[model samples]
Target: MASVFLLLVCVGTLLGSAGAQEAYDRLPSKFKLGVDMALEMRNSRAGVKRLLLYFKGLGQSDIQPGNDVTYIYHNFYMKATQCPKGTVDTSNCPFRNIKPEIDCAICYKTIAGKIQASPKPYINCIRKPALTEAMKRKRVNYCNEMGYSSGAPGGLADIGDTYF
Candidate 1:
C-alpha cells in the first residue's frame, strides 16, 4: 500500500509539471513581426527589450549571433501568416492579422525587412544599448507613421491587453 501511494504521488507531480511546461511552450518565444510592430507602437523601448530577450532565450543551435536578421524576419512573417484563425483561411489576408484583429502585413513586413538590413557590428548587437536604442527609434517612428501612440506599457501588459 505504501509503495502504491508513493507511485501515485509521483505520477501526479510529473503530470502537473508536464502540463506547466506545455503552457509555457505555447507562449510566444520568437519575435513575430506583427506582434513586435504592435508592441512598438505602444512602447518602443519595451518592445525591443522583449524581442532581445526572446532571441537570447532561443536554443543556441537554432539561431547564431551572426545569423541574417532578414531570414529570421522572414520566418516570423511566415509564421504569423500561416497561423490558423478560427477556421478561417487567413493566408489570403493582405496583412498578417495579430491581436486587435486587423490586417497590416504589408507594414509589418516592410519595417521588419528594413531593420534586418541595417548594419550591426557590436558584439552581441542585440544586447548592446545603442543598438536597442536605435531599434526603438525606428520602431517608434514606424508606429507613429501608422497612427499608433505610446499609450500603454509593453511586454506582458501589451500581450495581455492585445490578446487577453
Candidate 2:
C-alpha cells in the first residue's frame, strides 16, 4: 500500500511539471521572454502569472486566465491600461476607459550598462531600488529580442515603452 502511494505521488509530481511546461511552451516568444525576465528580476510570480494568462487565452491552460495587462512592466507591478489596447476584463483596473497601449509604459532600458533617465509624467515615478543599472539593461535586451519597441515595429526599442 505504501509503495503504491509513493508511486502515485511521484506520478502526480511529474504530471504537474509536464502541465506547467506545456503551458509555458504555448506562450508567444515575447511573453516567454517576459517570464524569463520577470524571474531574473526576482518577480517570478507576476511573470509566471502573466505567462499563464497567455496560455489560458490561447486555450492552453485550464487554470490561469489570459486577460489583464499583456505587457511586462519593468517595475514588476501590473499596470493595466483599459480597453481598445489592453484588456478591460478586470474590474479594479484604474486605467479604465483608456485606449492605446502606448498609454502604459512597462519597460526599462540601459545603454552600455547604464540606465537611461527620462521625463516622468507621474508624480510618484521613482526609481526601482532593487534593480541595478546593469540588470535593467539586461532586461531591456531580453524584451528587445521579443520584438517590442516604441511607436513602431522592428528597430531600436524606445528607452521608455519597450516591452513584449
Cα lDDT, model 2, residue 135: 57
Q: Residue by residue across 1-164, what tens digits does model 1's lDDT show?
A: 99999999767655644443343345444334433443234223443221111111221111222323221211111112222333233223222223222221212212223333222211112222234444544433443233222222222222221221
Cα lDDT of model 2 by residue, 1-164, tens digit: 99999999767655644554465577655444544443334323343222111111211101111222122323223222222233334222233112211111133232332222431111111123444556555544544443343322212233343333
Top candidate (lDDT)? 2
Best by TM-score: 2
The alpha-carbon deviation from the true structure for residue 78 of candidate 1, after best TM-score superposition, in angstroms, is 30
Per-residue lDDT for 143 in model 1?
Answer: 32
Off by over 4 Å in 1: 30-164
Q: Clashes in model 1: which pairs?
A: 95-105
